[model samples]
Target: MHRVKSDLLSAHIGSKPSKTWRAICDGIDVLKQGLIKRIGDGATTLIWACNWIPRTGIFRPIASKVPEPPVLVSELIDHTSMTWKAELVRNCFFDFDSDVILQIPLSMRKQEDFWAWHHETNGLFTVCSAYRMLVETKKNREDYFGSCGNCSDVQRIQKEWKHLWRMKMPSKIKVFCWRLAHNSLPTGSVLKNKNLANTANCKICGAEEDTWIHSLLQCNISKCVWALMDEDLLDLLASLRFSDPKYWVSYICCNIPQADGIRILVTCWAIWYARRKAIHEGIFKSPFSIMIMINRLIEEFEFVQGIDFKEKDLYQEKSRTHNWIAPQNGLSKINTDAAIDRTGTKGVVAAVCRNDQGGFIAASAMVIPHITDPETLEAMACLEALAFAEDCGIRSFVVALDCLNVVKNIREMP
Candidate 1:
């Protein structure tokens, strides 16, 4: 080990004056900058060369045009006590670098300088950090995404993520929009790329890749849906020409009025939904029917927004009779339900368990890929509730189900 270390230091760090070893020397020089000093006695670390700041990484402060002799970390600290020499630091560093250096508190006593990996938060060396350092140096770029030239637009798109959430829609719809913007929608092409599908063809038309543009705008089905809307709306959507979904969506959302933009978003989401129905459930709705549904939902939401919900709640309070019954002491009750598609090929089973006094406990939800029978779905929900209760270490729990036949079947079980 000693011989190996000697060979490496002599060949790279120290002088091995040969043209063949030039590349190795250059590599070692680049590697040295990635090493950060932990700031102890400050004797070994050079003030300008070493990276010591926790927040700023390895930023060198330039106070002079001509470089001077290297200053050691120890020279910046007062030897009488473990405190920074503010005057020396000010002379050597700019205000910001001096502030960062001074912010690093010294140890109770002087100790040996310790080196750490600057790229990682935990100060541990990792291959990932080494690869990143190499890539950054080779590319000679400081942008967040070093390799991609068009990353500036991507960064801009990220800023508008909040716009999707701001829309007056369900949380699920917002997530759908977010996924669409990211081009992460599990269309046929995406599924094929993931090896989950045999081909990248459109599930509805089986022509070309099921890209975001084709699935949402260019497909015959989508075109038919757009034809049902007003000519002005169709023109507005047609005017979008961006190949990237995020850029396209951002352009429309920012340029068009919010009301009209929301309608477009709703239509896009509905188109994706109809495609999913056709793919997973073998159920297809006509483009005209999909448009009607979208308009109905928008009108309903707008109408409900204008109504006095407080008065409706008051009326409900006066007429309400059905109420949840609490379980007995030392026992828990679980309510389970499944929301299944019309064709029964896909559904989500959810279970929520609560204590006797209705205090929240544990809950679980599972997405079933396929369940032919609705009754089987109810059974799966019951089983999911039991499994969740067991996982929570709840021994005594009553399983509640809305289906009476399911409840009777459970009671009749041995």
Candidate 2:
């Protein structure tokens, strides 16, 4: 039955004396049995056979039928196989294209099936080949075509260029890099050899020099600080045991609670702070001193957390002290302002008392230097005022602010 079908397709296509045509006719015979429903007329039979044969070898299906013998081998190849479709989907390899297809392979027709089969077969080689081709294509595109200047290298460049053109990089990568850059591990110098440096003497303690592993969690200094906190920084190190530095940074930042991590951050900060102080002050502080500083910071933070006072109390206390007392049962208001500049930021907190008669009794503003954000500055001002009011033994008051956000934020304070 197969032989008869082959002979019929060859006669309909042509008794072409070419190896290519003969092979194509055989393929057409196979496809015709499965694909074609009926070839009722001679011309129709020929058209049906040729359409199944891939005329151009480029995989494009021929829309126009040629009603002639010695059919263009190209037309048969184009109709049958989808080489051009494959080429287009593959983006001519990574060397030729630098962009990632935003759509998944399953979303595409031929490519979907191809990838499904490739995945089923565990064709890692083929998958890697395709990846390399894509990378090469992207490199060529960036080299010849205009490159996104911000992209430092081909690897950093993404395939979804069109989709991500307007969207900035997600905060994940930037935050990871920023955290890594800030933490220890010689920011500027590149360690030549990992194995050799891992065994080298410690730069600070005159003991074995710490490698990437030591600097992060294993070194004496780091361990000592952790021990002093009576907290297990080792658990954090264990969680990150298998991860790279970048992954470790992300894991730590994401997993640790804000408050608990603040302690860890301050501990690490104290370690580095003490190291710097030793060099600058020319007085080497013991590891105990570093631990003391960390404990002090934690205590100070705990103290602030325990305070309770209304924003109004701050205003009334200010008014009475200024010899400008407001009438009994009046509204007290507090104003917090934050100014940011390249040099630094300053937060000014002002308090005013108003009498039942709608007269201002007293007002005062004080600038707090070294504040970073307006929210923080406002919080600090309110906190300072609360402290001052409590010292003056004023129990009841109202806080007013031109900054609605600050007012809302403080009002929502738990």
- Runs in model 2 deviating more than 4 A are 1-200, 279-282, 299-414
> Going through the candidates in order, what is the number of backbone clashes in each?
1, 42
Residue-wise C-alpha lDDT for candidate 1, range 1-414, written one tens digit per residue: 112355342444334455645666776665565767887888888767666765433455545423573378787778786667877776767775666666564553547888777766445667788887787555545443455554433324544776666656667777887798788999878889899989999978888798888899889899999888778778887777888888887765666666677678889899999998988999999998898889877887668655332233211224538687898898899988877766745667799989999999988988665343456567778877876876899999898887776777666544
Q: What is the C-alpha lDDT of each candidate?
A: 0.72, 0.43
List the RMSD of every prediction in angstroms: 19.4, 26.1
Per-prediction TM-score, please? 0.40, 0.30
Best by TM-score: 1
What TM-score, to 2 decimals, does candidate 2 have? 0.30
Best by lDDT: 1
